[model samples]
Target: MKIKAIAAAFAATVLTPFAMAEDQSDWALVIHGGAGVIERGQMTAEREAEYRAAMHAALDRGEAVLEAGGSALDAIEAVIHGMEDDPLFNAGRGAVFTAAGRNELDASIMDGATLNAGAVAGVTQVRHPISLARAVMERSRHVMLQGEGAETFAIEQGIEMVPPAWFFTERRWASMTRSLERLGLDLPERPEGAPELQGVDHGTLERDEREHRFGTVGVVALDSDGNIAAGTSTGGTTAKRWGRVGDSPILGAGTYASNASCGVSATGTGEYFIRLTVASRICALVEFQGLNLQDASDQVIQDELTAMGGDGGIVALTPSGEIAWSYNTPGMYRARQTAGGDPVVGIYGDED
Candidate 1:
């Protein structure tokens, strides 16, 4: 009888690990385009459908990577690359213009397992700033690079560079001109070969105001190996002046990830996000405050950020495979998908 009891105990021990592994999450991903004053009646049906399609495309790219056993870092990079190329969301090609009529981009990426991160700012000629940010994290001992120095580094790494004109779009140019006029600031010269503007439609401009007020693109992912990663890319703000830099390239402010905590990527008013260290704060809440990813996101964005008059939102993923996002704005372009699951998307605050 004693021998039989010992054998049963050993069997239980052997099966325990397998049970835990079965319960563990395989992989998960989340993404966000910008967030602000978006409301139901503000956007035309055609425009809203386009945004939904774009979100789905970004999700497909990231889902493919995670499903293929790729690292969390790789999954997020793939997602951001698609958005940066899509003219619908402001990041790379669709970046909003600064007061000086130049498109100065910024981006950052983080590795949760290693706590390694990289960032770049004011990169005018690089075609894909997110790639440059990763190169900074991998190639150099530095965490951040900027402006002329960043462009030089891109050249050394053989990343694609395009003329500043490549970033120009008629809608962005018109937005900048209107903003400058509102602030009584002088307009800068148009980019070479820019199309002549008759007049931007008032409805179109209003829709864009809500959508692009805090324009940025970001992604966070948890992979099959239980690692997490987060990244963000942006063009600062429209009509920004004097070499302004937003939170997008600041590690803890705009982007943060940790295997022990959660990965976070934020889009909103840069100054407010920077002041609160929004991304890191959200993770800290989950790690130390004993809150889940969803509640932690709410505390920072819906409660604290809103109290401070800040507007924006964030996408987050925990090591255990929880995906969450919270925005004080009326709408934010976002989506999520888990391994072997169909993509789920949300735009308005009412979505689950």
Candidate 2:
């Protein structure tokens, strides 16, 4: 009897912690600021700390909702709202200026449970384009609204609107100026007249591409109810012309989710992502080929996109609380938190 009782107590002791851990949470969340050529040499410790804090704050926003039994869509959207308000990332306030010396923002959100999505492109007046995207998903019959029409829909929905100048920051303005100078063009005086975006010469796109760098913000989440969602937001490419829009506002390119597959949110060169359908392709691999989330993402980012010389990455999550990511560039600004794990944020390849 003594030996039996001792064995039972041992079993209880081993199982108690596991039970507690399992009960702590069943949800997971991941986010990415952007991915491309980030190096330790480029950032000071203080700046890296700030990026870490910003990512943690965004994670907290989503984790709080998931822990409180909210849906995946609600949690991911809330996290993106935090990112859009911060100037350190390129989504809303910090969006890059176009060749026309204006800011055009794009955003999209998807619900995995229903595969329903909404997006907005070339919207200059909306304060938080993600929320406007949600409003489109829930309120409108259309899947996407673009340009001035998107703005009109946003205003009619009573969403908070901001002036176009509200998106301008000194940093972005400087970037615009630098881009123009690289192409041997003069910077246009903002608020005075439109920029001379026409006939800017050819070798400029490669130069402008190097100057603008890359940035977009994205999130993927798994809720307590086993539902999933994904979202992405961005200021279009720097010095872009003719109302150029990126993958951020495209449902399958920047964001995709499916309860049967996985939720994927990508950050990279928007043009490449658009051509590849990066997000949905990852989900499709999971759903059709029966690969796990990590394997599917790895195959896509490492094999397919890499073959095309694309540089980018994705933060992907499965409904069962699995987290996975892949990037071909030097690094990817990424973070992830699971049911019983603390948050982990990384800016470089080695950090993960």
Candidate 3:
């Protein structure tokens, strides 16, 4: 009788931690806007409330999917697609204008189950770039397609395509004009004329140029099935020329996923990110070097990317229900929630 009691206690002890881990895995989702200087004083109460509401909506959508036993890929796509439709973010309908005054969107998606990936770049007519990215992964033979070719593929695949003007917004247009002015390019003046300022000089111009370097929105999720997935979308950089492409459309640079490891989404200077292979490097460090998710992300974003003079951040989630949110910039628009809990959202470093 004593032996039976001892065996039962041991079994309960061993199952406790597993039960805790299982609870943690039900639905973990995280999202981020581009990292930049987000000052609380500059944001109005109304604007802050809007951001909070948007993030909460995203968290709820993903949670619903997990609650229904959906895959991580489905949950990640649903959340990101919702953000793409939102004008407050720089993606899909709300993308910034290119140098040619047209919207050029890019997007990528990765499946941790098979490690398969898909991407689209320089697409102008696709209504939801994330949907096109998923189609590229599941329906098409190519991993990436660009420009008109991508639009053509999107149409053939029955994805929604919108008119070019549908993507234009007054705020994004204003941002593009400012970017062009900072780069010393001549642009048509606003109807109200430029505002007169005191003491604005070359230094201010240089700073403005640097401020426009970051752009993109992403999501990383761990579903109830213990699978991980990541998705990223962007309108590319403002005033970019020569059909320029950013890291958001690239697989290893902008996003990565592995069922045995983690999913990562990066936002920053795409050039430096691609050279560093930012997303894949994080997974490699964690899997090969035995580093935890947080340490691996910090070492890459702070030590590696910062060392290269690149400023940006990454959102990552491990299969074991761990979340790693790291960035070297002054702030990053980010939100996170585990399972059915309340979401934590922030725009600046100090808020963290």
In terms of TM-score, which candidate is strongest? 1
All candidates in order of lDDT, best leading: 1, 2, 3
Question: 37-57, model 3: which lDDT tens digit per residue?
Answer: 556665557866877788778
lDDT of 2 by residue, 1-352 (tens): 0001111111334322112223323788889988766776666578678888999999899989988999888997899998888877788987888887888999999999998999999898898999999999999998899989999999999988988877876667767777788778767668333333344333433432342366789999888778889999889777888788888889888899998888999988888888999999999999899987777888888888888888788988877666788888787778877655567777878765
> CA shift at 281, candidate 1, in angstroms?
0.7
Which should have the higher TM-score, number 1 or number 2? 1
TM-score of 1: 0.92
- Reference-based lDDT, each prediction: 0.86, 0.79, 0.79
Q: What's each prediction's clash count?
A: 0, 0, 0
In terms of lDDT, the best-performing candidate is 1
Model 1 clashes, total count: 0
lDDT of 3: 0.79
Question: TM-score of every model?
Answer: 0.92, 0.87, 0.86
Model 2 gets an lDDT of 0.79
RMSD of each: 7.6, 7.7, 7.5
* Per-residue lDDT of 51 in model 2: 82
